[model samples]
Target: MRLLVIEDEAPMRTALVETLKAEGYRVLAAEDGISGLELACTEPFDLALLDVMMPGLDGFALCRELRKRGKTMPVLMLTAKGQVDDRVEGLDSGADDYLVKPFSLRELLARVRALLRRKEREHALGNELSIGDAVIDFGRNMLHRNHKDQPISSKEAGMLRLLASHPGETVSREKFLDVVWGYNAYPSTRTVDNFIAALRTKLEKDPSKPVHLITVRGVGYRLEP
Candidate 1:
């Protein structure tokens, strides 16, 4: 899974990043709310760990803005404040969960797993999808192919899900930018190209002559079953 950690304290941020990485999650970090908001809105992440106290924007405001833009990815608010009202306010601001400072890493991981499980359950009820040889078990956030398991990163899985939902139809570049990247920032087309290349490499029988994922000359891409 990919996670974004938004915390200003250098020590805390470093520790969180290292711990999450050790747990096998790809992580991105931002020092303040502005950068956090930017990364949250521009990058593909399965979840966000946001510190409520920070310079400029603050986690509450950032969470609100993300909700306003219809971003429903899970958010866990972290703060030194440990009051009932504070936790209520964090949830009201769109956080899926709240964590008090000095929290055990074990508890944090547990909450993350819970939230992802909930999301997967919700996704399963909405669509049944397949990409290449992999059948997506959205309720489990898992992909199964042949008798072996293909370990896919969360971002890659999200991209594949989108493609699978519209098999045989072209998915626009702008749609990918808005959905996968999340915000209005202009990343080079190369970014999309690179991800597609990576996806093809992992999922295709012949990466050089992909059968399921095809590039449209001047448009975007189409997935052929």
Candidate 2:
């Protein structure tokens, strides 16, 4: 599979490129967040490894931008911070997972494999789907509307695809968190709510008065699209 490695540290960048290539992956590397964002936006990659700290456009902002642009590939954030808030920020910014710095290559490879397997399961659900005026390309994790296109994170695609698969059905919040974020995601159902808000903004004609994505009050949400 293809992978993107975005690290500012020269030695770390080279090591990642070499290690991933040795493991039979097609690799792309960038030294800064700007160049990384450009490559990530234009390239087709199965996964990405992004550094948290950088000279400009830090990883958090870059990750948010990735979601806004609709690139839904799994991201494994690399950070030296190792703080609870930092990890929370990474996940909240749409990163699929993270590895604290000074990690073993074995652990990194294992995590990468796990994420790829998860994506494989998600992509098997569907490919092209329509909601309102938006056409979703699940294979590429992008949203196509009118003449414009934006990338979507894999989590968003999986959740939306799940809802679309069950048209007019109200899937519960627990189901959403369990199925999408898995068993041990961060506490609080607010995570699911946040994702729902993001989806409303993208798929609904009016986010404030969502039509295609309607919340079922005490239950969860239903997709009429």
Candidate 3:
């Protein structure tokens, strides 16, 4: 896989590049966020490792810009700040995960592997999905059912993709929050249920008693298909 490492610190940048290379990944490194942003926009990368604090542009702004420009690769933000607010800001800015400074290389690598695995699952799901009588075209953010094309929100698509990624496995509310809404951003787990209900209405023949999207009482949910 191709990985982009954007770090202002020379040692950290070199170490990351070397380590990733050792693990058989093609890597590109940038000294600052400006060059990082340039490379990110111009190149095709499977993942990005961004430093939160940089001279030209901070990681938060860079990530936001990447999303605005339609780059959908998983972004892992590296930062010295480990505060809850800092983590929240990083995720809210479009980062898929955050790693604080002084972290072990092992943990960092683990996070990278996890993100890549998630991406692979998403790719496996492809751009189109068939649910009951409905067909979802994720590439165009549209769902066609009953001879009508209905728009699906990105959040809805994300939640469905996450559940679809793990068919028959129960996905907890906490997991949904962490992946779909960012970690601990929403105050209530009911938010996940609400979105699930919306998805059921669209995908299930009977929303009241959903068969494909099954809810585990006192637990979470699982997708049969």
Using TM-score, give the best candidate's number.
3
Q: In candidate 1, what are the lDDT values of residues 1-40, reduced to their tens digit?
A: 8999999999999999999999999999999999888888
* Per-candidate clash tally: 0, 7, 0
lDDT of each candidate versus the true structure: 0.77, 0.85, 0.89
Better by TM-score, candidate 2 or 1 = 2
Highest lDDT scorer:
3
Per residue, candidate 2 scores C-alpha lDDT tens digits across 1-225 of 999999999999999999989999999999999999999999899999999999888899998999889888988899998876787788779887888889999988887887888777666666898888999998788999878898987679878866865777998888786556533356688878998999777777789998888889998999887
Cα lDDT tens digits, model 3, 38-93, are 99999999999999999879999999999889999999999999887898788878
Which pairs clash (backbone N, Cα, C closer than 3 Å) in model 2?
Answer: 69-151, 70-151, 70-152, 71-151, 72-152, 72-153, 72-154
> Which ten-residue region of model 3 has the weakest summed lDDT?
178-187
Model 1 global lDDT (CA atoms, 0 to 1): 0.77
TM-scores, all candidates, are 0.56, 0.63, 0.85
- Tell me how far the alpha carbon of residue 81 in candidate 1 is from the true structure, in angstroms, after superposition: 0.6
lDDT value, candidate 3, whole model: 0.89
**Per TM-score, what order, best first?**
3, 2, 1
lDDT rank, highest first?
3, 2, 1
lDDT score for residue 104 of model 2: 94
